[model samples]
Target: MTKPPKTAQTAGGETHQSAEDLGVDALTTNHGVPISDNQNSLKSGTRGPTLLEDFVLREKIFHFDHERIPERIVHARGSGAHGVFEATDDISDLSKAAVFTKGEKTEVFVRFSTVAGGAGSVDTPRDVRGFAVKFYTREGNWDLVGNNIPVFFIQDALKFPDLVHAVKMEADRGYPQAGSAHDTFWDWASLMPETTHMLMWAMSDRTLPRSFRTMEGFGVHTFKLVNAAGKASFVKFHWKPRLGLQSTIWDEALKLQAADNDYHRRDLFEAIDTGDYPQWDLGIQVFDEAFANAQPYDVLDATKLIPEDDVPVRLIGTLTLNRNVDNFFAETEQVAFLPSNIPPGIDFSNDPLLQGRLFSYLDTQNSRLGTTNFHQIPINAPRCPFGNFQRDGKMQTKVPKGRANYEPNSLADHGEDGGPRESPAIGFSTVNAATGTDESGDKLRVRSESFSDHYSQARLFYRSQTEAEQAHIASSFVFELSKVGLLEQVPGRMVSNLLNVDEDLAKRVAAGLNIPLPMKAPAAKEPIDMEPSDALSIHKNMKATLEGRAVGVLITDGTDADELAAIVEKVRKAKGKAVIVAPKVGGAKLSDGTQQKADGQLAGTPSQIFDAVGIILSEDGCAAMLKEGAAVEFVMNAFGHLKAIGANDAAQPLLDKAGVVPDDGVTGLDSKFVKAAAQRFYAREPSVRTLA
Candidate 1:
């Protein structure tokens, strides 16, 4: 009998067996040999070259050399967490998927990523966000891979490579990494009319999301849901944040890169770690084949969207991310998402982009993961018991018990164990409609005429935005196109494409770029002014509440403790966070002679990271801060970014120096300041900066 290891309590107050007490068997080399000393390699002297005969050193170095798997080609920079998906409404009539059964709670892992840039890139780039969720259900693993935007740049899958190549860093210069605001992207986008609709969204405030928790996600392609009776219906998936839509202004987004490179990633990690779990309601727009046929735009077109007003979204589930990953590399990096990983109740549509993705994801995973058994990786593995005749691939983890690795084996007759068999009754089946076509014809390389109406939805999106949002869109276009120095004609061509979307938008962009307006590009189909959907506008749909938002309070030595405490308490009561930003991390000494700690230092954490800002200072503190450039810029930037500001009487001189005028958003520290901090003052934009 082995002696039990001695138990000890960790710093986190959890009891665990002491590693040293576990004995020699606990620490071992790859070959099962016990390691005596792992801290140092075998060297001739204390600071000499390592000996080549040291097997432990050799093994450790060799393993470290191959430790990293290839990063994802698209969504390389990502963050993940563990969570549960709870089905709140019964959708058995639409799909027989166990994950969709009422009251069923399926364990899930979710990864959010930026579409462009390498693993080392900053999080605040203007790029599409990948929202991929892997659900470990009773049946099998199901991956819902989607984007924050509802539509895509191209309708056909073959054009995906070209689109990515254009948006990525230039091959020769390798410059403008992690952003599309460059020559190559605008040059390619101006030439491709199919990209106009998506370009509109890319340049909008949607690309500058304040945080991942506040962003909305959509399945870019239409999918099919199959019932137990073999009935299929067209479906589109959506994830709406409970906190509502919120986006940073263009200037604020730029400042955020300088403020904190991992702003979004840190925000998500801290939110979950603090037990303030982020949640999204899963909704689906389900319609029959008849509804698809009646739509003016083709259902298979990836650039088009079914308006929420046309087909109301039916809320079916809620996904809450309550736990953070224990290991970033093993879980966040190794996890793979396949669009084709559908369960028995789900099927595919003829959406060409989706069809191409189904094949692309699996192939990419194989090449990147360097194994056909990538699914065996714990993060990507199925939770349910799974057995198959497929055996012996690279990195195979399971060992089949018997010699009968093939189907229809008779090893059981000899009293030997037989492998598991398939169940056709519960197995996944493709929808019958997948083989049928509305207009049957031979396969061809040409695009369908129904997919050519590229400008209508672009126009619809632009016209639907509020005046302030439209101005932001126009300014973004100007900023991106202005960077196209290599192609002198690119801006004009892009402006021409914009003409089809909105004439005023094109004219504004042209004026901002100092270029003459060009004629509208020839549309394959004429544009139509579709009715504006209020849901398409962020400002119109945003919840004017401070819940889940952060407020930064700038303080210094001799600050008024009572005023600072009161504001912080009010923010907490509103379900908002109060971050103290002081001149030093050691924080300020209040008038009461007590030293306080700060959440951030003045120079590192800027006002851009917070929803609103409050300045609480004593006469001496205010005088000291007025001399510091960071303090002036903090208040000035907050006002310029259209954020609410709260100030104490002692901070009046600092506000004057920062050029802040009396506005509804700029309030004294009182009950009114709390209410004002809940929302932005968009009307104050003109006084701050010029718009396109």
Candidate 2:
């Protein structure tokens, strides 16, 4: 009989078994072969692309792909748009891809999605957003799949399955749709310290974007760019929004979820329909091996990021989403994007997380589309001519023309068209000279020593934010940890991990939870303090402009027509949108004896949906609105959310009744109102609410 494995206790007093205790009953493959190192995948060298012969990796990912049928396992709820990417700068020396040629335009499709949600989940959840772009270049297709945040939770692909399993709705009860504030997620996160850095981003306003157009996109892993000279350089991709970065506060976000379930999707479609096309600039941080080696952390680690201060991003192209899809199911639902689909000049790197993604995305498409010929779909097909002799599978749409299906056939000599052949001259080539990768190197599953530091960047990110932002982060942690009810150990375990990131953050959360702070969790490697970078804070980088903002104007019967017109004109002049809200959607009688139209009903269009709000009311009109519950809450919420509120003298009584204290954001319906509408009143936040 086999002896039972010995149990080990964690800092939180949780019992778990170690690999050394497994002895005879060890973890193994389906064939019963013991896995030597389950932490990392098989690589050719210390830092090299994953090897195909790594059957352990293929088996693990293959099973995960078919776990469900039809709907995607992750990023299930998504919104897509058709667009064009035009090269605005010359970077031919850095890359040979035609999509980057100056003055060149390529057709592109982009999809924005929420992670860890089902197809029917709400869009306003505090979750990571997927920003994936598919470019139909002359050289074929290139998919730049990324997220709104720069760093990830895990470093290696082998742990991806575990991370997803923990974060998803718990297996036993199946609750908490599209959210991570649960026991399973916190329990898993407490053990993995590498999730610290991304936790700061996840808890901040970055995940609660004002709209899809207001978020920044990032390629989370390091990639390689090859020039026409065959010289390769490391590169990272960034998509800077033209509208600038903006996010909804936690309270506003909750109210928005209750008001509208499809806020983001509707915003994207309306922006394109109204000819206010959303645009973003494509930027790249180019570097060489020398620069990568000098960094304190490994560039190949997915949990780490190279600060923009180290390598300033250079703008090269612009992408404008100009068209909405004709059919939602045909275009948006069926579109497939694979990270492995890269043009000639753009190539893969040895990043373990990225290497696993190349294989996982292809298999995912196969599972969701339920066919190998999914590329034949119109939305996924290439614009340029493409053909191959290999054919015949599930849902095969193309029919071969001749009997010369076999390659190296003499059919061309017999006056027959031999299908496409390999072209070494104009085809994509993988750099194989004295580069970093080598197929002949030793095969091992050990992780590199450089990939151990996990908390340094987390500290840098927390300290970079403004005081208000820091308070929000601490409050967010308290709210999320409080939801882990009855899992008493999980909350303290998480606070222990936070101690390594910031002592103040840990104390704030501990005090909020009403629990004693525990000692710091064990660290794999001691964290070092790095220079603060201003690029990390959304507050520090926000632009005080109304280029893509929306303002809500409240009007009543006998309201001043001149004041309403002035507000609309001023909002429009600033390139912002003005929406009129009234008691009835049909309209209200104005002072000019005209029945003015209202864009939305006051009860339906709460102040949470707009960036700023205006209140214009007559003496009798204010008395009537004071009796309505929705109207009172509307004004109160706007004030509590720190949004600008413009009111006429007659509306002062209503504001006083709703507890709207005088502040910089509250002004008379004059030039001061328009000027104040451009920014959020962060200074007023401390007075309106208490944070952890």
What is the lDDT of every predicted structure here?
A: 0.91, 0.91
Residue 673 error, candidate 1, Å:
1.5
Off by over 4 Å in 2: 1-69, 432-440
lDDT tens readout by residue for model 2, 1-692: 32334665779999876565755566778666657578899998999999999998998899787654587788999999999999999998999999999999999999999999998998899999999999999989999999999999999999999999988998988978789999999989988888999999999999899999999999998988888888888889999998888998999899999999999999999999999999999999998887887898998898898899989999999999999999887888898999999999988888989999999999999989989999999999999889777689897989888887888778898899877798888788887522454634688989888988889999999999999999999999999999997678999999998998999999999999999999999888999999899999998878788778899999899999998999899999989899999999887899999999999999999999999999999788899999998889889999999999999999998899889999999999887888888889999898889899
Query: Which candidate number maximizes lDDT?
Result: 1
Which ranges in model 1 have alpha carbons more than 4 Å from their true place?
1-26, 39-52, 434-441
Task: Summarize candidate 1's per-residue lDDT along 553-642 as a digit string, tens digits.
Answer: 999999888998999999988889999999998999998899989999999889999999999999999999989999999999999999
Clashes of 1: 0
Cα misplacement distance, residue 97 of candidate 2 (Å): 0.7
Compute each candidate's TM-score over C-alphas. Answer: 0.95, 0.89
Q: After superposition, how far is residue 336 of candidate 2 from its true place, in Å?
A: 0.5
- Backbone clashes, each candidate: 0, 0
Scored by Cα lDDT, where does model 1 land?
0.91
Report RMSD for candidate 1.
4.7
